[model samples]
Target: MYLTSKVVIEKEKIKKPRGLQNTLHDDYVKCKEECRKIEEREITEKYIQYLKTELEAAELVVAQESAALQATSIVSSNNQNENKLDQVPSEDSILKSEKETFVQEENLIV
Candidate 1:
């Protein structure tokens, strides 16, 4: 789906062959092969570019979803923490109850 190498595509050397000579069939065949190679490289480069763009869009969607998930988790955790705080007694109330228990224990000892 995407390019594996950091460098996208290697540039092919543009061959500037002179006008085709029709004396021999071999020369014509060679020219056709060269043209085919040029077309192949052109299409290959365009396909690679298309793949790169699709990959970029996919990455962006993944990033956005990940951020949304993290935000939801954070808000859920904060809500849990707030609920815990509400359920727990204050420090001063805990201390006052402990002192009253201590006094009762002391009287019972006496």
Candidate 2:
């Protein structure tokens, strides 16, 4: 019985070192994971800032394009109106032409 008790104590002593090593390994893994989380958070923050800057630049481009489109439309509309005016005779010219036609016709008949 004494020999058996001595063997059991020896076995427990051996198991104690393994348990301590496992505990130390677990602590090391936990610390590594925590550090990784912090690094990931910093990378995420930088990425968010980059995306925000890109978004702002895109918005500025869109605004500039919209302004350009508006100006082009305004100029196109003004040109179209000018072309329409050129195609149509003025009221005063039409009335004067009609009066000359009547006078010539009356002179010819007389």
Count of clashing residue pairs in every prediction: 0, 0
**lDDT tens per residue, model 2, 1-110:** 99999999998777555537787798988899999999999999999999999999999999999999999999999999999888878899899999999999999999
Worst 10 residues of 2 by lDDT: 12-21
In candidate 1 the C-alpha lDDT for residue 65 amounts to 100
The true-versus-predicted C-alpha distance at residue 41 of model 1, in Å, is: 0.6
What would the TM-score be for candidate 1 when compared with the true structure?
0.53
Give TM per candidate.
0.53, 0.60
- Runs in model 1 deviating more than 4 A are 1-24, 85-110
In model 1, residue pairs whose N, Cα or C atoms come closer than 3 Å (at least 3 residues apart or on different chains), thus clashing, are: none
Name the weakest run of 10 consecutive residues (lDDT summed) in model 1.
6-15
For model 1, residues 3-102, the per-residue Cα lDDT tens digits are 5442343323443344533446667788899999999999999999999999999999999999999999999999999998889798999999999999
Question: Residue 1 deviation, candidate 2, in Å?
Answer: 14
